[model samples]
Target: MNWTVISDNWLFFLVGAYPYGPLGGLLLTLLLAVGAGILATLLGIGWGLSLTLTSGHIHRLLQSVCEVLRAIPVLLLMFWCFFLLPIVFGIDVPGVLTVIAALALVSGAYLAYAMAAGIAAVPAGQWEAAQASGLSQRQTLRWVVLPQALRIVQPSFVNQWVTLVKDTSLAYIVGVAEFTFVANQVNSREQVYPLEVFGFIALVYLLLCSAVQALGQRLLVKPS
Candidate 1:
């Protein structure tokens, strides 16, 4: 309705006070999502390998850790990282970094399950063949199992990334000033264009999520 509010604050929505000061808004949101996604992916891969490759106590410990992490809410994780860690550790961690840390831990736990499912999807025959070919377990995993697992789980990984992008909105909880935070700020200041402000950001999120879906489809297609 009130297009003027959107017209005035679009830059703030896209990149709040970038050159002028700290980065915020959609750009910062993307940056945080990307950082967390990368870290989570690496953590997931390591955890997944441990889950699939190890046995007895190591496997049970990792499984319990994943379960515990998964059971905890992301909001609670962020609160602990931002508010509790400082008091406990007596170290000053930046809000943005704390948000990323929380996101990565939560995302990593979920993606670890995805990675485990991917590893399990690998054919038993493949493992038998790898073992018969004089390869050790680690060698077979590195050379045979992981490659197939990664390919099988590409779409799932992309879906997790999309989820991560949306999850970055929670960064607003810790005063991280992401896209949602900027939109809320605009609404609070203008008091007249809540629909316009929120609608615009919703469209942005739709486009970003759609782009990620398209990328997943493209990557899934086999080359001729």
Candidate 2:
């Protein structure tokens, strides 16, 4: 492996065309993942909880919307967000933000179902006990249900987060210049170290994903 290629171009891979150009690179990758994770949690869990707790018109409407989102491919979503967002909404949206939104929608679609399963896994007695204690339905959900449901689905949420991290690679198609994109650029320019450069890229992704998994597992573990 020509370690020097990575050694020399590490900064570019880490931060991309920064301080001189729009931000892009592994930093952008993290930004995209984190941003998407937050948005996905809000959209996915909120919808899941609402659907589980609600019924009739509200549930049917949400089910239809999420079903449509889930049916659309993530790549198509990214393209639509980038190309059509401005035209349809008549407002500018940067490429990176567009990618984040797309990833969030993709990840959230799956997460919503996972959250619903978690909520369903909660026992019926727990709901009754909360009501027996004179807690409102909202209070019961907030204090008793959410904690348990979210905890039960911790592994799934973590998996979705890791999946989103990997999906950041797709942003390259739209010129996001994240980790994979920057690495590819360096390899192309140098043209002598595909194996070495890609090997380094794999290592970086491994480290990133491992750290995330470790932290998630730690959080998911039962208290002693």
Candidate 3:
């Protein structure tokens, strides 16, 4: 099925108009996923902690908001931010930035819930031991609790991250030339080789996801 088309345009598929146009393609996909995932990881820490640490209305409110974010689709959030922000706030949000924001906002909520669960999974004795050792509450969480909790949640975080990477294809709907977008563009012109082109697309996604999953499994291995 005309494999040369794939072989010929591999660079474009990987990098997209780079060195000549806007930055995009698989590189952009990874960038978006990494940027969004880091943002989510940091924010999730706060949101998640509020679940277990905070109380009263503040806790309920944070929980509600995170739940709402989790309920909404990423594409809807992207549309809201990309279109409404500029028109309502008089801000011109870049397309790539909007995708990152949307992905982070939604996925971060899940990460927050995962993080809270991870913290809960740590035995009560560990908390007591830290307290008996005279570590302050903040110090206990910062130095003792979070590291272990992070390790527990690492696999879940990696899963979310890989999903975010695949979701970057949505950027194409708004004109960002991400991996899927580039593939679609190429396919439209050389319509005869859909299988060869898209087959490569699937392979790229499989490799990226598999590598991430393997990394997570490696982290699960106990240290000697």
Model 1 lDDT, residue 197, Cα: 86
What is the Cα-based TM-score of model 2? 0.94
Single out the weakest 10-residue window by summed lDDT for candidate 1: 215-224
lDDT of each: 0.87, 0.87, 0.86
Model 1 CA deviation exceeding 4 Å by range? 218-224
Would you give me the overall lDDT of model 3?
A: 0.86
True-structure RMSD for candidate 3: 1.8
TM-score to true structure, per model: 0.93, 0.94, 0.93
Residues 147-204, candidate 2: write the lDDT tens digits: 8988889889899888888989999767888999989899999999999999988998
Give residue 7's lDDT in candidate 2 (0 to 100). Answer: 83
Give all candidate RMSDs, comma-separated: 1.9, 1.6, 1.8
Model 1 lDDT tens row, 34-99: 899889989988898888878999899999999998999888888888888789998777889988
Please, what are the lDDT tens digits per residue for candidate 3 over residues 1-224? 56999878888898999989988788988888789878987788788887889999988998999999999988889998888988899999899999998998898899999999989988888889999999988888887788788888887888887888788888875788999999998999888999998899999999988887787667542433
Residue pairs with colliding backbones in model 2 are: none
Candidate 3: regions farther than 4 A off: 217-224
Please identify which of the two predictions, 2 or 3, would achieve the higher TM-score against the true structure.
Answer: 2
